[model samples]
Target: MKNQTSITSVLLMSLSDDQETISVLFIFFLLIYLMTVFSNFLIILLVVTCAHLHTPMYFFLGNLAFLDMSCSSVTAPSMLSHLITQHWSMSLSECIIQMFFVIYFAGSEAFLLSSMSYDRYVAICRPLHYSQLMSWGTCAEMASLVWSTPFLLTITYTICLRRLTFCGPNLIQNFFCDLPHLFQISCTDPTINVFILIIVGGTVGIAAFVITFYPYVRIFRAVLRIGTSDGKSKAFSTCTSHLTVVTIFYVSATFIYLVPDTSNLLTLNCVFSVIYTLITPLLNPLIYSLRSKDLKAALSKALHIHRLHPDTATRR
Candidate 1:
């Protein structure tokens, strides 16, 4: 029988047991991590340096890109290291730390996207007040709220979660040590923890989604009523990028939460996690640039900055 005392929450901080799988997966994840980082960094750079992207919409997109970059960075690199090394242990402290950032970044991204959607709605529906209403102060306050609120709540949840004793098997069935996965492996009943997760999570995380989307329902009605064909087209196009991101994140997240945690579904869980965490960041830059002509222009200017001093740029 396995020794009850000899167990840990993190299985693979360094090369895990699955050597062949780890080798292949490590390369794949490394490529994705670099892409996510580069793409998000470029998006943020374009938003900040380019005059055309100084609007509130791109402002929010910039933050989303930042959050996505952070979310992927917090988990993916360490995870890749675990897949390739002999040491596969994340102490309780480390695990909780990872969990905190992951949840915070994830939560912040969600809230920001919802806020962005509301910004789009205001711009398209209430053009007169769009600028005045979504001024620098308002934007900063919203951004602060998004960041600080999620950070505090997730820290509390993670603290409570880490206190649970791990007398059972330590082998985490999935790639990363998620809340549900950890609770599932515990020796005692995780009723209270799971209950808290659903209540706190469903209320805060899911509530943000509801608040964001419900307004869109009304905004779409207004979009349809626009007198000019061009007006309708523009309004719909403005929402396209936000909708794509929201759909991608919410769908994958729902699946991860809705599907009863089961060994049979472990593979599916990992795949869906990749969809939201790894894949979403790459899509954000491409989607924004392609869908919005303004972002494309900003990107052009950003690229042009180097062209202006191509010789000097190369020297440095």
Candidate 2:
């Protein structure tokens, strides 16, 4: 086994080795990366500029959009570059940094989703207290906690990873440097890392999952209690988008992380990783914007304003 000094880089596996397949994948994923960035950015812009959207929910959404963009960025560029150039090797430090951000944003997004669910619960179940419960200050505090806590956890995980030596067979099975893939390549005993992953990571995931979905139980109950169909429809509409996103995120993520990464499952893991990392970000803005009348109106208004005054829009 080689020491840390000897292993300076690790090779990321490509989705395909065939030149034609690589080209097709490059084009497909490049488009996905671009759309994910642009759409998420649009959500942030709308939330920032549209006064109507300056509520606690949109505030959390803007943060989610930012996180989605960031999480997609953490891997998509590197994966896309590898697809195009077939140069799959990255410096070990770069890989670690990428892994850190990947875990950071992912964990952060999970908690943020829980926050969004809580926001929805307050709005629907306790409408009278929504203002008090989800004030700007409260939202800011939640956002701060969402970002900071995961950061510290990721730092601990990364520190543990750095202590491990990488000797031979440095090829990562996935398109990016993920925790499980990284553990598989370590020359040193990764028992501690695995322990932290299983205990801390599992606890965090379960906590976030409970926080995120438990509200929906009450929310559904409240929705069911509504007298009129229109009233029920309106309340359900508000939550459906968020619920869809949360479901997709957790389901895809669970498949990627929980499933055994055996030889037969490697390809399936790659597919799920694509769903979790690439497709989810791409779908978020579309899901929220399409389902939301307020967002649609705001987008339309923004577009009309842009068309009416392209110069002003460009200056801004």
Candidate 3:
């Protein structure tokens, strides 16, 4: 029989038991964490400095970049420290705090993603109404909704989930304290938690994403109906970056949550998480800059001026 007491008595699972693997994992994850942070920070800087990127699209792009940076930062750094010291110990409060940040940032990302989809939909579907609809005030409100509502949901679930008991061997198989990971490590029946996860993930993750895309789908249809080569190219050109982001985000997220929860499939889930954690943040900014004409122009001028500063300095 296990201890079934209050939330203070609950203990989390250790990350791993292998000493050699832990050290190796620490070095690898540290490098990844550094790159993820640096690249996203650079994107934020470029977005802020480049005048042409001051539009709604870039503004939201900056938001997504910041969220990605935050997401990786919250999860990666702690995991690295634990791995290096082979210390799988996380205090109860620390575990809850980690989970809070994880959920907050993850929920925030989910909301921001939906908002980005809405932004794309308006820009592509109703170009005439975009300025009116996606005005600065409107944009700020959209971002707020995207960040706040999900956080409330996550906090509610956390409060409920944290009340469960755990008084046995605690060793989490995964690299981090994920939602499903918590359920697996718990002593009590995680039926309610899993049910809530499915409900929230399906309702918020899938439904919200679908709702956001409804307008974009219409925009995509409208663009395809146009007969002109130039018109089709232009319409697609406007949406290609967003589409790429949508596919990467949706595909990876669905794979992680929708997969059957079993030991055999855990490896696949971890791999998918790595992509969401490591790659997409760095890739999104590159995709936007590569695909968007305004970004390309601004980035080019910014880089050119940057390159010239050294020569100008030498002359001075």
Candidate 4:
């Protein structure tokens, strides 16, 4: 109550209130979190240890894995804790921190997927120059831009958020700290926040979508131009996994955030949030690893090498 005097904390509602349901949800989410962590970590480990995966494509994949892990971490642990204890209290500062990273990682991922698409475009469409275009230095720069742009955007938004006050009821409808829920509870005018969300969020999402899919337009043309069926098949195979990932991610994210957020849609929001936050992270590594024979072979080779020389894997 003392802290409430200054609006220091907000209480979050649980996904479920029934004891049995809570128990089930806790187990389900715990498993999801663990799997996301393990899968992403495995991808990172594979990319780092496998000598064959040192290309720009794999470099972007590694960054994607890291972003997936980070994006999930921003909200999943708190959701897990709330599922067990049903005590979802987060201080103002903590909420802001979570919101910033959630936005940063999620936004970065949107752009990172676009960057990966560029890498693929260069590989498939500009095969001869792929090496020069997607060099390590260029890949590093792309990765830095993908990450740093979102970092700046989120920091700017967070700074704007800090200027607003939260003097009303402090119950966040969702399990995590998201902009919509926070906007619903803000005492100060949220016009600035709404503007930022529209301007920054819309620009990022639209640009990412265009950048990610435009390459595909040319990629499809290039694939069709392949003289041999085998060549076409191979090129399509390389893209299908990425296309699948982009479809799921953009669909779920667009549905969750861009759609109308009415008071009665809390349940819908939570369900959609789970899709993008928890399920998508789990799916990314599986899609990439399962689809890429190169990754599988490298993983097997790395494990074999690790067995023969464990120090080699660790040193990477």
Task: Name the best candidate (by TM-score).
Answer: 2
| Residue pairs that clash (backbone atoms under 3 angstroms), model 4 | none
Decide which is better by lDDT, 2 or 3. 2
lDDT by residue for model 2 (247-294), tens: 999999989888888889989898999999999999999999999999
Sliding window of 10 residues with minimal summed lDDT for model 4? 1-10
Candidate 1 vs candidate 2: the TM-score winner is 2
Error of 3 at 66 (Å): 0.4
Off by over 4 Å in 2: 1-5, 314-316
Whole-model Cα lDDT per candidate?
Answer: 0.79, 0.91, 0.75, 0.87
lDDT of 3 by residue, 148-258 (tens): 888888887888876566643455555566666666657788888777877875677776777656767788798988889899898888878887887897788778767
Report how far off residue 70 is in candidate 3 (Å): 0.2
True lDDT of residue 242, candidate 3: 80
Better of 1 and 2 by lDDT: 2
* Root-mean-square deviation of Cα positions for candidate 1 versus the true structure, in angstroms: 2.8
> Could you arrange the candidates by TM-score from highest to lowest?
2, 4, 1, 3
lDDT of 3: 0.75
Q: What is the C-alpha lDDT profile of model 4 across 15-76, one tens digit per residue?
A: 87799999998899899989999999999998897788888888889999999998888888
TM-score of each: 0.91, 0.96, 0.86, 0.93
Per-residue C-alpha lDDT of model 1 across residues 1-316, encoded as one tens digit per residue: 2355735545632333577877888898899899889988988988887877888888898899889898888878777766766466677557667767777888898889888987987887788998899999999999999889898888778777755767656666655666776676676677888788888887997789887798789788998898999988877888888898888888988888788767688677778877877888788877887898887777676568779989888998
